[model samples]
Target: MPGDAARPHQASLPPAPRNGLVPSLERRRLQAYLLFVAMDGFILLASFSAIAAAYLGPGGDFAGVRQGAEPAFLLLPLFLTIALYNGTYSRAGLTDWRQAGAKAIAALAISAALLNFFAFFAKMNAEFSRVVFTAGIVLTGAVIVAMRRFLARRLTARWGRGAVNRLVIQAGGPKFSLPDSIHIDAREHGLRPDRADPASLNRLSQYLRNMDQIVVSSSRENRAAWAEVLKGTGLHGEVIDEATRAIGAVGVVKHDDIGMSSLLVSNGHLGLRARAMKRVFDLTISLAALIALSPVMMLTAAAIKLQDGGPIFFRQRRMGRGNGFFAIYKFRSMREDDSDGARSASRDDERITPVGRFIRRTSIDELPQLINVVKGDMSLVGPRPHALGSRAGEKLFWQVDRKYWQRHGLRPGITGLAQVRGFRGATDTEGDLSSRLDADLEYLNGWSLMRDVRILLRTVTVLVHERAF
Candidate 1:
């Protein structure tokens, strides 16, 4: 049980992503959103380079006009950051070519306007050639937007070939059918989810590893069983009550409207304004940290490399916001070929290298996660990200408490209220995690800018906690 894998196979309304939609480079392997940022930035820079070369010729006419496109690099990160907020990097946002193009262009224009606004305020607009900047930026934005639209069409066209997401339904309230995009495997004809026995539920659990979108009816008898089965399985679900006329919204469903007959459930989380403020806070603090801690990070990297001639960074796949998966970065604190990365390290774990132990104790190992914070995968002050297979002494964290996931309502953080309050380290029992969740819920309920600052200030005291093995 300590080494058991996660389940709740991810299945959306349509079938899972088809093979052809992904590029040869990305075939089979999922690409992180940052890959899009890097690729698009390259495309933009290349377009600018071409335009600059053509206008200025092989001669160095640009050196006098702009002193080398220094502004471009600054602008690229800003544009990409804005694009992130505009949903250009979102999975749902990229599904539609037209919509993606519009969002990208709009973000690009806003970024350019802001750059010029800053330049004008600094009285530095005259340093660059207006013609080159205008032509290059406009062409770059158009080209980048067009390329993404092409990618979108390539991805969406795969579904046109009848390849869509598959669903395994066990509900028996009323036989519902979906479009061609979803293929249902209703194995049980009259199995009422509300009355499902443990044997049936256990059977369903086994198959859940390969299915998408699990749903269970909310009956007094089945509620706890459903929660237990779903817990720590990495599968989110809906509690379908018998009063529900339809299990899900069918034809003519108004956009985002909760209907009386709809079965859609709500787990209240951060509001939009709070989310926006959180993003701003993360970006600002991470940028400052990167600038402030560059030297320390470099020294740490060198130390790790010289220790065993092994990789400096250890990458572990962790769960992110909205139940999505992301690869997190940390300094290598264990043997390069260690067998178990998912398990928590004990006080005398022999796997730790001398340099690794020092860095881990100093919390220097977590510095690379500043990149995660910058990328919006994490927050500065929130719950810490956990590995997929992370568990307590013998049980997974989600199994420890029913409210474990409610903490995930916000993005995982580098330092949280729990860590500041001295709740860091391995959880040998359910109570250990329950105590941490109590602190987490308290932070979420009383969230404030000053509270975040105080928690951040308090985080320093727990950097060398007894849990840092």
Candidate 2:
């Protein structure tokens, strides 16, 4: 090959087996399990206490009779089972505060419902106060979420970075591999670079001098050559199987491999029933929103007309599913000019009128998009629709990557997961775009009516914060 010599010699030094020296994977897993058990216990305790306070309060004899202990014992196990079945324990590290809080709330709700159902069937419903049950669930959920946040902060601060695997690579090819793929895979495994080098072995040596472990990703044929090159460097050497490397690095089993298939057979498409329900919900909600916000929309139109001599409604052709184009509607938040039509509005952009800024920040400008939702061109929750020609530098929104349009598989949303997560507004970098897509895909895979409601709630909170324009 013309570029064989130019191919930088790379080495993979697999991490040393910490065996008895450091915390083992089993230990970590056990610790995580225990943490969840403790959390469930605490939640159950809080729930019991709250219920007692609300129902068998100072006036009630059952408050001090230890009668609630039996119920707590019964509910704690059920709560744990529900939380486990919901993938709460397994996904603890991957969960954000919003996700954790939502799951805790959901698990508590399910447990409460089951408990109440049993009570009702046994004709013991009168034994407990409905207010007590409701208050208990609410208070327990709040306390659990607060505790989780505290624990999460501590965990992230103490171990998030340290728990990640460290890898150093020496490129030994004419063309260096894409950093994006490496970063993506690394992020999945919580493995990240302390530092990266694309050039000389000396740089890699200098970088890894202080690090205890490193992994090199390069061709199998170059493994021996790399090992021989660093024979006396006092660093261990190992070869990374490129096929398995990507899979293992990302902790995803390759579909073609039987090992992975056996472990994850339950991986199924989002259910058809769920999709149908979502569509129905979207239609009903969008229609209601359009009807309710019509007056506000009319007022916004008048405001736009009075402030800027531009069109009241801004409609632009945005890329929808299957590369189809649809005119997305929004209140006119920018000037009627070529610049506004051609480019994304940036912070302090001259095209944005003062009223436009306020509307954009408050997301009142997006209220008109409910019409688009009602028209079936969009949904109340999904990926935010971008103009067909919108791009970052030379990369058009759709042209950036394949996953960019994967989000378009569902209807574009007026207030998407991305917007609620503060990834809204101008996406000037690939990182911003990638994060937005990630949030969108997360929503797609985990869409539920409850999730929609939560997103709406968070959207209000984000609007109030006004951190992102």
| Best of the candidates, lDDT | 1
Lowest summed lDDT window (length 10), candidate 1? 20-29
lDDT values, one for every candidate: 0.62, 0.57
**TM-scores for the candidates:** 0.52, 0.43
Error of 1 at 426 (Å): 2.2
Clash number by candidate, in order: 7, 8
Clash pairs detected, candidate 1: 11-212, 14-165, 15-164, 15-165, 15-166, 16-165, 383-413
CA lDDT for candidate 1: 0.62
- Give the true-structure RMSD of model 2: 18.7
Which residue ranges in model 1 land beyond 4 Å of their true spot? 1-172, 175-238, 242-265, 336-342
lDDT by residue (258-373, candidate 2, tens digit) is: 12211111122243345557778888877887788788778888889898567888777665532245688878787754422447777778878888888887788888778787
